[model samples]
Target: MTDSQRTALIDHDVWNGGLFGGADGRWYAADQTRDVIEPATGERLTNIGVARAADVARAAKAAAAAQPAWAALAPRERAAVLRRAAAALERNLEDAARYIARETGGILAKAQLEVAEAATQLHIAAALPLQPQGLLLPSTAGRTSYARRVAHGVVGVISPFNFPLILSMRSVAPALAMGNAVVLKPDPQTPVSGGFLIARAFEEAGLPPGVLQVVPGDADAGAAVVEAPEVRMIAFTGSTAAGRKVGELAGRLLKKVSLELGGKNTLIVLEDADLDVAASNAAFGAFFHQGQICMATGRIVAHRKIAAELTRRLIDKAQTLPVGDPASGTVAIGPLINERQLRGVDAIVRASIEAGAVLEAGGTFERLFYKPTVLSNVQPGMRAFDEEIFGPVAVITPFDSDDEAVELANRTEYGLACAVIGASVARASAIGERLKCGLLHINGQTIADECVNPFGGRGDSGNGGSMGGPADPDEYTQWQWVTVKSTAERTPF
Candidate 1:
């Protein structure tokens, strides 16, 4: 699709002016405005109004005020609304996908997948209301006792730019499903896909006003959401550094916080692994979406017996994948999100090379279009091996023994996702069990998420809280114990 054709898909009147305050279905102008740039062309897509602390407070207050009525509705009623919203998302998938591609520089396929995942999240959320909310408890005195889940008043969702739709919906849908209002603060760079699209979906599905508010802004807006007294919980998806600040503030406020943070994940290729399959998985894990995903494989730990062959195959894949504007629909890789991200990726590659890592392929760019890069002989201390590069770069480190391979993979502090590929599924599963990551894949790639599965990480990647499936109830609601006595009994004083 042409750039103009993509931009024409969304309603210009709603987004052209400024901030979209989902509380009232109105656009509020801001004192400062941020230009949304299409990374592929380095051109201005549109200008979004920057939300401030006061704006966030307004949204939070609205959400708090709307919470009781929303929570009072029958579970079936809520479920019906969520189901309609999921349908709306599917009906408008193409339009939403175009917006995602234009705003985030993702290929059409990736954008469509994101929209599909988002709809799936809503469908999952719809079923949550029908699940049993309370459980019977044993009582010694013949008094009836039970424990039931209740929603927190309001939830604050701070989402990242990459995979904006899916990340935002995973929290927003479940929070709303469990009877909590949400104040979403999407990253400024992707306000439309991350926030506006979601708000529109719910609005179209007949959601009450103030039930969900999308406020796109910077750190100030996020802080306001976290600090607001009415907001009882915060769901954050971003970098580890930023997550620490959010967690500390939420901790001080005594609020519930679910954090899905960064990962310096690894893909392990064993001696008996199929070189072709191992290399394919590594490239897909590291280069998909320009490797902007938090679960992107940052390092490849290969056995010495097969490392050379695996590296050669990886280099070939890296060198051949097409890189250009995703709107063209022909390239396999698109541009980085922005110039700053491009520079960061380049610096990591250069620093890794200087630190004695071999540049087997890639390490070149034009504008924000960074070619997929592969670095060999990388060690524990090297920048590419140690840091979350957040780019299309793969680092390979060879180990002679299974113990050393496990050691190399476990050396990093970030443990979000890991993948093990070997001829023996049993051996691979054993090695995977020895690793410390939260999500493990045997004979597969590292980047994956499902609405039915529990998604989270350990160490710096998360704070013991998870999302999706049974974890959703824990993250979005609190347990309350109730005891009933048919007749009043007097106690000795």
Candidate 2:
């Protein structure tokens, strides 16, 4: 069927797909369902199935049983599956983008970007199986040795609500390409884009039954997926608090875990930097998707000389950007994921202002919609400066020297991503080297990525695991050294 036709069926309630990727190689309706409320309009978007612990167990069991047969397939054949999936996703890009906007409360442009990123990720993963798998090694006389890479069997993925599509595919595509089955537990808030859309793409691409199981669930169901005996590893994207729980549980179970957690990312503007460019990039970095991204620029450290100009420009720019429903093509900023999140962001911003942060512009909200906000003269102890205010809020703090800027950037517990904007590339590079972060950008926003870059975080942000480029397959598989010998060598004791 054409993409439009299928989406129209979904929009019209004519194609109400189930939630569970069953052990019997088919989708099944759950015992219970929950209403998925649209963040933009505060209305029911659809009713998605909710998986319980039993459902999680069934999915994991199916993944374990299907893994061996999938791994046995020729590498080329496996790669083809991912390629087909990518094609299917691209074909349904518009439909999926609309779903993303409705469910996540993201702007239309951001939703479109997410779809594009997912397609690119899938395409990149499709080449994993075709890449060289082992290395030749010199050995003793009449013996040969080599190191081979193999799948980790069944991988469990627990994704977050923000950027659900790309984050899930970051692990799912790579795991499948590396010859492993996956049990995906997408955030319940974004079931349509996170769960059903992905399942449809894979099914349309003709992926083997039981290779991928998506469970739409909450915290309890997520814990069940992590605790499943059949799951060998877990890839999670969420908050640091949640990451700690997942990491601790996976550590106790001796399962490999890769986490893409929270961040209070910093963006530095040097004295010689272009104020206009800096202001524009800063506004985009802090307000895009209502600043829900883990890598969003939460803190802006500027040199004392240009700090005022940059902050003023940012305040004015933030005030002018339209904020409203995602469907309003002109709006750049949209509502938060839910009412609770809106209230949390509101509280944080208010606390920061009370703690001496100068509210420069836009510090109000209507329902779930928070205005694009800028805070100047923000001090270290303020909630806006110290915490991840996952909303359209940016705080500007002045620093006297390059050393102080680097120090302020490193003060936070997070070391996820940081950016430096300066006239001299050499100076920026030097400062970038001194910052403690997993990803660094010079003359750009804190949030930037490509298919070739190894995307991940450091410190509380993650556990030294990455999800792109050559490192992705490494994270999803195990390396083994195999040696063949013609005869046993004699040893003297």
Candidate 3:
């Protein structure tokens, strides 16, 4: 029922799960569905399908059966379609950015940046068409003995709410460029618009059917996606608890799996740090997106000498951050994605205060726009201090020495990313070396950019899943090796 303008696929009508939609003459709906709401405001936006176990199995099987023909296409040919898709995105950046902000409660600038990244990422993935590497082996001196990177077939990708557009693209683009069909499942809250548009645009840009299928649903669909045997690989990003489940299922299926899970990151500010600069960085990192980001600076270890001044400035700045509508250009911060996460933030901070921490500023704002909270006197024992409190609250404590700061920073189970703020390069480098994190930033700190760093983690930080950046998605794929000898040269055999 798909039209020429968009590529659409469906599960068998008998398998109607809990979600359904119609686009370009194709109708899809589940028997049960959940409504989506704007986190900043509790108004219902739309309903999303909550897929049944059967739907996941169907998508997985389809992806597997289509893999071979897809893999056989010239990499450059696949890249061309990606180029077209990128071109399509550039033509509609404004609408796409708006959709992302509205659905995910992302600020306009940040959402636009995401849209820009999506376009650039499409091109980046497109450019990697011929990058499959081959090495000359010592075992065959007379012939070119080497291996080639190839598709791993069907890769199941599950995304989170924070970066719905970008993360989903991060998973889909590379998988597509490498000739692998994808089973993409976005967070139920923001599923319909941004991702649905991407699928539509790519199809218009000449992508084939069954390449990037979107199955919108909740955890049950996620489980279905991971457990299917036809799924060749699983790329997931979310909480650690959920990641454990996904990993186990992938193991049972004997498939390749990559996970990017929870993070409890730290920002180290030494005495030599620029107080004003460090304060500004800390405020933004801890409060932007209402501090729901995984790399949000949840903990801060400031040098005792500058701790008081830096803390004061950070408090002042955080208090002033604009919290309102996502579409408004003036608003610098937005609401939590949902009430559940909002309650989670409150519970963590409340326990920390009860357990002997001081609530500095705006510790618990009543509005949907959770106030930017900064806590001092926090220690390792409290859940607010120990776990990933994905909210706009930050816990700051002073450290007299670099060793104490590094030790305290590295104490968490999650080591996704860290930041070192200091005036000189030596301090930054020293702290970076001692901090146990997958990605460490020196001098300045920010969430992430798809261009500069391909991200993952050590310890429980991440399971070496690179969404974008240096890991080279072109190379992230599975590989194959082959050799050929002339008939005249094969006499002995």
Candidate 4:
């Protein structure tokens, strides 16, 4: 992204002050607007329209009215539309990548990865409707019984700023493929990449009017979506604090809810693990996208035998990671989403150092850019180990035995994801089973995700509602049992 390209993105007038509603098949300027600031440069990117309570209700009503017709389409037809959307995404990949990197302050590589993952998500979701035996089941002697999966009418998708493109698709693509209309409320900080780009792809692919809506705003706008009467399901990805509120509101209304929240994930290196590989994985897990990832490795529990070597390697790795403008070539750490997050990470690093943790390398910050930092001597009570750092800070703590490593890994309140790296795959697999997180990686980084693999978290991380793979539609639909009687003998009603 050159200065001229950045200027063009920042001055783009299409999203300067508009809310998109698939219902009306148009973008409308709102009564109020909010300025979006580029975190890396502290420059005004653009202004976005703020959706009010009434706007959310209108989107919901639009979705509800359009859903039945959408659901009535043959499965193959819906699949075709989804495939077209995927193609559209691919066509817009580079421009979308630029928008994402500029808006989210994520590196160009991470932004490109997000766009590719989103395309994959759309393609994978298209297959849901093509599965021949998905809703079919075995029948008893006198009757034929099966379950048909149906949409939950309207699904409200609320995604975070970090991983905006993929996180939005995790729910949006699946919901649309399953014949559900969507009312999306993206993070206020990233409306363009999160809500606008997605809507544009589907729209250009000829998605029917009212099938998707983008109403971008802050917490108030998100609350409106959650509180809307017509929304039957809510797919949320954010902090545990906000997720809890969404769960509470949805639970009271008996609305289905799926949450992918925070994590204090761990990366374990056993005694026999290769220090080179373990350190490399740790660097990637802890600093990629400046560690804004929900499953970023927060704690590293190394076997005492290899702790010294691994810690030394990790410190060296952090120091070498390029930290600056995300638009630059092959950068590792980028600016955080905002100044608040930058300050928060700074405070955590400072407090952890004061709490007896050793600051090994890279603890400085300039504006929203925080260096990829390494912390050693991290103890159980230290914030660096116990809480989700959500920054480019890797904490290393030595454990004497395998049992101790497991104990330390499971000590945190979150159970989102973790990694165990060792020479023996079987041993690592066994140890992974003993770990408490919902997702685990053996001999690799915890950062990898696939559209065909189930993705979510456990405990404070989520409510066990998963996204992706064959089960993704489960989060956005309901299962109704259908049965037919032979003659009248098997009829119960």
lDDT of each: 0.90, 0.88, 0.76, 0.86
- 10 residues in a row with least lDDT, candidate 2: 6-15
**Model 2 stretches astray by more than 4 angstroms:** 1-17, 487-493
Residue by residue across 142-197, what tens digits does model 3's lDDT show? 56556777778888889888978777887788888878888888888777543565
RMSD of 3: 4.0
Using lDDT as the yardstick, the better of models 2 and 3 is: 2
Candidate 4 clashes between residue pairs 3 or more apart in a chain or in different chains = 22-210
Return the TM-score for candidate 1, rounded to 2 decimals. 0.97
Backbone N/Cα/C clashes per model: 0, 0, 12, 1
TM-scores for every predicted model? 0.97, 0.96, 0.91, 0.94
Give the winner by lDDT: 1
- Model 1, 286-338: lDDT tens digits are 99999999999999999988889999999999989999888777888998988
Q: Is candidate 1 or candidate 4 better by lDDT?
A: 1
By summed lDDT, which 10 consecutive residues of candidate 4 come out lowest? Answer: 1-10
lDDT of 4 by residue, 380-431 (tens): 9988988898999999999998888999999978999999999899988988
